[model samples]
Target: MQAPELVERMLRGDRRAVARTISLVENAAPQLREIMAGLAPHTGRARIVGLTGSPGVGKSTSTNALVKALRARDESVAVLAVDPSSPFSGGALLGDRVRMQEHATDGGVFIRSMASRGHLGGLSWATPHALRVLDAAGFGVILVETVGVGQAEVDIARHADTTVVLCAPGMGDSVQAAKAGVLEIADIFVVNKADREGARVTARELRQMVGQVEHGPGEWKPPIVSTVAAKGEGIDELLGRLDEHHAHLTATGEADRRRFARAREEIEAIVMSTLRARLGDVHGHAALDKLADAVATGHGDPYSAADTLLAALDT
Candidate 1:
């Protein structure tokens, strides 16, 4: 279908169109410029939330439960599950979809699994574009479940309006979250598998850690919720906390600030990608090779070579 037709259909909530648009984004199709232009005006209406944690933390289970809670409230939801890439096919492992099969037949929920494709940040490099597709498709809320690649998962904070970090009892997740630097980025923390032993200890450690970080007056403090997600336990409380965080974001104008930063990051990424592509071209590569030779031989400084390359691109 033409870009305009695809955009029109997607905006009308056509599931096939939404899927096809995300495919185009993942492949970086030539039609994206037009498609994105057509969809841009309709974007920014969806609440984007990100869920991340270490493996075995029941991130998928919690996500499935959250989807149920959100749908019960009559909200339209889209789930973007970024999964570890398969070595042979470079596609998502599909584990997340398998776990979420209960929602497969629910028209109110849209679920997509994307392969991280070796992206180090727990997300596919195409994630931001795919998010735009979902947002323009009129999903009231979008849940971005990142590949549980500990440490590097902080990238989700840049893409999401609210970030939920999950921890499991006995996983040493509180210490891990602190080590991974996710504690600073989390808006809400979930101690999933709360029925397990050490659950209270995990929650206590989280609370103590949170208390240590002094927030300026009126600054939002991350709240920890305990959940045994496999049984749908504590999901309503989790949803309530999510609502509170969203309200806090809007009331304090943090939502606008976050969105502005997200847009700026997106734009900067595109510019960097364009530059890298151009630098891979034959002429630019040749220039870089010559500059590298000069630098190795002490004939030119690295700074001067970089300036020359940038000058070449401008011309």
Candidate 2:
């Protein structure tokens, strides 16, 4: 089907259409621009929640539990599980989808696994666009699960409305989060596998860590919620906290501000990518190579060469 027809079908809640659009985005197909333009007007309705952390923190399990909780409240949900790329096929490893298979048959739930494709920061480069497709497809809540790459996974904070960083007992996650600056990006922290030993210690350390940061008056404090996701424990409280955070964002007008920032980042990313591609075009590359040779031989400074390149692009 054509891009416009596919978008219309997606907006009408056709799962197949949604899947096809996402695939187009993931592959960076030639028709992507048309598809995004068609879906643009229907976007911005879904709540984008990001889940991230180190491996073995129960991110997948917590995500599944959270889906059940949302469904119980009659919310239609879509999950974008970003997994590591398979070295051979350059496709998603599919581990997360396998773990979340319980919801596969639910009409209200749509689950897709996207390969990170060597993109750092734990997300596929196509994630934001895929999210737009899902939002336009009429899902009320979209959960984005990032690849569990320690430290570098904090990029989701820019794309998600509510960023939930998960940790587990004895994992040294709190220390890692502090070092990686994930603590500052988190809007909520979940200590999953709470039934395990050292659960309270983990919670206490997180609270203490959060307390060390200074916040302006009325700033939303990230709450530390505990959960045993495998047994579905504390899922209700987790959902409640997410709802409370959403309400806070709306009440404080931060929701609009956050979304605006997200759009700005997306636009900037696209522009940079386009510029890079333009720089690598045949004619541009010939000029770039001469400039590089000049710089390497000390005939020109790097900054001047960069400026010249930019000036050429302007013409």
How does each model score on TM-score? 0.88, 0.88
**Residue 87 error, candidate 2, Å:** 8.1
- Tell me how many clashing residue pairs each candidate has: 0, 0
Across 43-129, the per-residue lDDT of candidate 2 in tens digits comes to 888899999988799888899899989999999999988755342463444564575578767889998877645443222347788
Q: Model 2 misses residue 30 by how many Å?
A: 2.4
Lowest lDDT sum, 10 consecutive residues, model 2, at: 116-125
Q: Which parts of model 2 have CA positions greater than 4 angstroms off?
A: 84-91, 96-100, 118-125, 149-152, 282-315
lDDT of each: 0.84, 0.83
- Range of the 10 consecutive residues with the lowest summed lDDT in candidate 1: 116-125
TM-score of 2: 0.88
Top candidate when judged by lDDT against the true structure: 1
**Count of clashing pairs, candidate 1:** 0
